[model samples]
Target chain A: MSTPTHEMWTARLRGAWQRNLPIEKLLPDDQPAYVVSWIYVFGVATIAALGVIIASGVVLAFQGPAWYHTSDIGNFTNSMHFWSVQMFFAFMVIHLWGKFWMAAWRGNRVRTWITGAVAFVVSIATAFTGYLVQTNFDSQWISFEAKDGFNSMGVGAWFTVTNLGQMLLLHVAFLPLILGVLTLVHVLMVRRRGVVPPIDAVPGNMEVHK
Target chain B: MTGWLASFLDHPATYLKWGWFQISISNLIVILIMLALFAAAILIKFPKGRE
Candidate 1:
């Protein structure tokens, strides 16, 4: 009692999905068992560090540039934020390096790696903008100094580092928006692909190649 | 009011006052340098095929 139309439609749908995606490889629920190591924490750690940075950054933003110099709590909060940012960037660099060393970009993930690298560059630029928004003496110095470098590169007129308004908007709104989107894409790709197994994971391939 | 901002700004550069948890700029720079060297050491020691 199998209906030919239903079976034919199902076959066509399956073919379409297979044509659009390599369904044989990117199964939704399959992953290597070796992915259960403490080494996996580095990625989570980097994400947590970014969370701390954003929390601290919000407090700093609410207080504004004058508060860091005027209020005691503001100063302390600002210091915590500054330190958190430094730590966040440091951990992110490590996490990125670990992924690179493991060659996690292999298989169907080459585009993901390139997109992530672009995100890293953008994040660093966002951080530099945050520094300029501080408007403290250090911020002033870095701003003018960085402006000269940008001018020499011929993009200073377009970016205009002297404008605090523009810098603030970019830091709080634009860059964070870009970061959020990129992070979503990166996480989705990771979830879809799952963790890649180590090269020496085979039952008979465990012999050290080096 | 102006004097207070100036004084507060200068104080961070002088005697450390933010308790044990507080990190000084010099100490931060040293820790950063150590971290960089540590990462480099890992890269050198681990090499490519060994890890």
Candidate 2:
């Protein structure tokens, strides 16, 4: 059998794209009438926090990891970045917990829930890598401590914290890319399923479980 | 912007002077201001669980 030519591959890919689902089918512009509460903001809040984290991370990148460790300006930017990361994790955990208590996995949303949970797990790993990249006193302590933990768990056989080159690559590239992909998948699943409806339709006193 | 604002807080006429400190100070101030704005938005947007 002959290998597929570039033109054939491109044509097949375009056909797949044409067959792909539309965004509107995934998520409707008009939400259910019962979705009128501030609790929903947790998801958006997490996204916003991530926005800040990315922006701070970008600036810190431009300043370079070495500069961040040594220079005064870079130091402050690094601190801001650290705090942003903390906030990002905080918001994500809250959002995930909130969704769980709300039984957001109901109906056809099990896939969405699973995707979200996987994304959350990846995000935690990303944050852990970020801490390793810090290379501060905290980073040193965490490195040794976490290295031991992972070693005990047999994960250290593959991943090493002391390898600066590997850690840098994972921090600046791999972890982020993994998190980004998982987040994208989670979002697609959520949009496809649409937001889960609140339990009752009463406007004045309808209560949804935590 | 934040760094400049902070430096300007210390020396208001530093713009008349050239310093490598400008970028740092300016970015710091911008970060601070943006943080405050975001905090305010959060408060307003999520007020009493109206999310």
Candidate 3:
């Protein structure tokens, strides 16, 4: 007897998924002892700050620019969004510095490192779009100042910073979506590959004194 | 509060300029604080426990 088409496809997908990343590795309960450093905390801290940024941004979006400029509550939420972004960048850069020094791609974890680096680049673009959509004098000044740079690179044809509508849509939708997906992939790769062990902790290496 | 503290808090931002570089005092302070925090994170001892 032949298996049903749907069952066969489902079985193939399940086998591939399980072979690549089992459930335990995906949602690990423990980590290597080397991960017990304060430096490791910065990655989770960055994610936490991103959560605050998204929550505050959602509140700001509901109220709109005029409300945020006038209402005290709206102003408070805007501040939250702004400060959370500051925290996010601060933590992410610190985490990146720690990872670089640690040679975080030491094992077969090169994809994890690359995804993180790509996410950092994407975040800068996301933040730039955010600045363009602020609907304030600062935004106007920045857009005017940045226009020539974009034009010089030939990106201004499609990405006109002075166009508030386009900038706002990119900031509020496209860039955030891309950043979120990049972050998710980076984290999953970290989980699947496992955290890179310390350089000196490798067994049977006789290059230096203990 | 003290006079200097009040002045620093209430007055417009102070800026430092040298050649082509200029930065507001508030921004400089925040940058310094971030540096300090990074150093502290590296130096501080983290507690270890079994998972």
Candidate 4:
């Protein structure tokens, strides 16, 4: 007798998921000893900074622009958000540089590298939208200056940088959603693939006690 | 001295301009710090975990 359609589909999906990503690989107790490098810490640092950025941003969002502009607590939260973004970019750039030198795309990890690179590009757009929604003179100047650039690129019609409401929505909602999803996928890919071995080391055979 | 420091803090960021190239001192400092951190990350020895 043939299996029921729904049961077949569920079985296929479950089988694929378990076959591709076993629990042990997803959360391994021991990493390869070659993973003992300070450079590897930058990726975690970037994620930590992102956590702080999101926390402080949520606080700033609850308080209105005027509150952030005037109130001491609001100003402090805004500063936290700003500085966290700086840290995020700094650590991410360092992480990217380290990964590049390591040739981290080896061992069928090209998608992981691609997702990270695309996330960086999307982050720049997210940051640009952030600058546009700051509700300050700097934002004002930036919007006016950026509008011409967007227009020249022939995208100003849809991406109206000068429109504060639209820019705010993009900054707080659309761009962040994409960035968050990309980050999740990139990290999951890393866990599934395991860390890349050193350039000269043979994979799975060069375990050193570090 | 206090007044001068306050004035300096309140004023616009000082920029270093060389022809078409220009950068604020604050931004330059951040860049330099990032470079230093990157170099340190590469050079510094990582701790060995339990054998």
| Top-scoring candidate (lDDT) | 4
Share of native interface contacts present in candidate 3: 0.48
RMSD of each: 9.6, 11.9, 4.6, 2.6
lDDT of 2 at A149: 86
A55: Cα error in model 1, Å = 1.4
Off by over 4 Å in 4: A1-7, A208-210, B1-6, B17-20
lDDT of 3 by residue, A75-181 (tens): 78888999899999999998998889889997788889998999999899989989988899989999999999999999998989999999999998998999999
Per-residue CA lDDT of model 2 for A106-204, tens digit only, reads 877888888778878878887888888776787888888888887888988689986667787888888888877877787776666667775554456
TM-score per candidate: 0.68, 0.68, 0.86, 0.91
Candidate 4 or 2, higher lDDT: 4
TM-score of chain A of each: 0.78, 0.80, 0.91, 0.94
In candidate 1, what are the lDDT values of residues A169-203, reduced to their tens digit? 99999998898788777766776566655655675
lDDT of 2: 0.71
Candidates 1 and 2, the one with greater DockQ: 1
Candidate order by decreasing lDDT: 4, 3, 1, 2
The DockQ value obtained for model 1 is 0.11
Poorly placed runs, candidate 1 (over 4 Å) = A1-32, A203-210, B1-51
Q: Against the true chain A, what TM-score does chain A of candidate 1 give?
A: 0.78
What C-alpha RMSD does candidate 4 show over the true interface residues after superposing them? 1.9
**CAPRI verdict on model 3?**
acceptable
Residue pairs clashing, model 3? none
